[model samples]
Target: MFLPNPDAEFTGSYERCGLTLKEYQELIKLSLDSRTFLVKQSKQSAFAKLDLYGFKDEMVFLSGSSDNIELLHEIMADYGEDVNQWYQPFTSRIRHIRAMKSQSQYHTQTQTDVFEIA
Candidate 1:
C-alpha cells in the first residue's frame, strides 16, 4: 500500500519547497540526458565520474534542494526502474551503490570511490 505526495503547485524555488511535479520531472529528465551525454562525450563509464568530481557541483546543488529530495523519494516509490539517475541527490557512496546495482554486471573497481561526507 502506498500514498502519494500532496499535489499542490509549489511557487517557491527549489531551496524552499518545490515546483510542480511535472516541472521537476522535466528538470530531472534533462539532468539525466546531460549526464548521458557527459558519459559518452568523456568516454568514461557511467560510474567513472563518481570516482572523480566531474559532476560534483551539480550533485552538491541537487543534494541541497528540498524539491530534489521530495522528487527523488517520489520517483523511487512510483518509478524505481529510473532510480540510477536519482543518485544526484545522494551521497557519493550511495550513488556508487545505486549505479553498480543498476548495471547488470558489477565491477570491483567501482568500490574504490566511496565518498563519505566525513
Candidate 2:
C-alpha cells in the first residue's frame, strides 16, 4: 500500500490519499529516527507530459507490503487517535483496489499454444 501527502499542493487536483503533509513527514521522520525496517520513505518525481495533468516536483511516498497490515497498525498506534480519522478512508481505498484486481484476474482469459514436431 502506498500513501502520498494529501496536503501536497499538486494533490488537490488529483485523488487525495488521505494523509496530511505533517503526518506524512512525521511518519517518514519516525522511520528514519527509529531506523525501523517496517516502513521506509521514498522520494518520487513526476515529469510533465501531455497525458498527465497533475505533476509534482518531488513527492513523498510510504509503502508496506500488501500482506503487512501490521505496518499500518503500528504507525497508527504510535500516532495515537489522530491518525484514526484518515485511516479508514485510506484503508478503504486499498481494499477497493484489491477487490478490483481480484475481479479483473477472475474475468481475464488465458491462452496457450502448442507446437507439433515431425
Best by lDDT: 2
Give the local distance difference test score of model 2.
0.44
In candidate 2, list every pair of residues with a backbone clash.
none
Locate the minimum summed-lDDT window of 10 residues in model 1. Answer: 36-45
lDDT of 2 by residue, 1-118 (tens): 2233324352553226454454445444432223222222343422221222232211111435544455455546655657556466546556676789988887774545778998
Summarize candidate 1's per-residue lDDT along 2-112 as a digit string, tens digits. 112234223564214423445434334443323322122222222222233576546645465675566557656654645465454345545665577777354653556
Please name the candidate that would achieve the greatest TM-score relative to the true structure. Answer: 2
TM-score for all models, in order of appearance: 0.21, 0.26
Alpha carbon lDDT at 70, candidate 2 = 57
lDDT of 1 at 1: 9
Residue 114, candidate 1: alpha-carbon lDDT: 57
Model 2 Cα displacement at 106 (Å)? 0.5
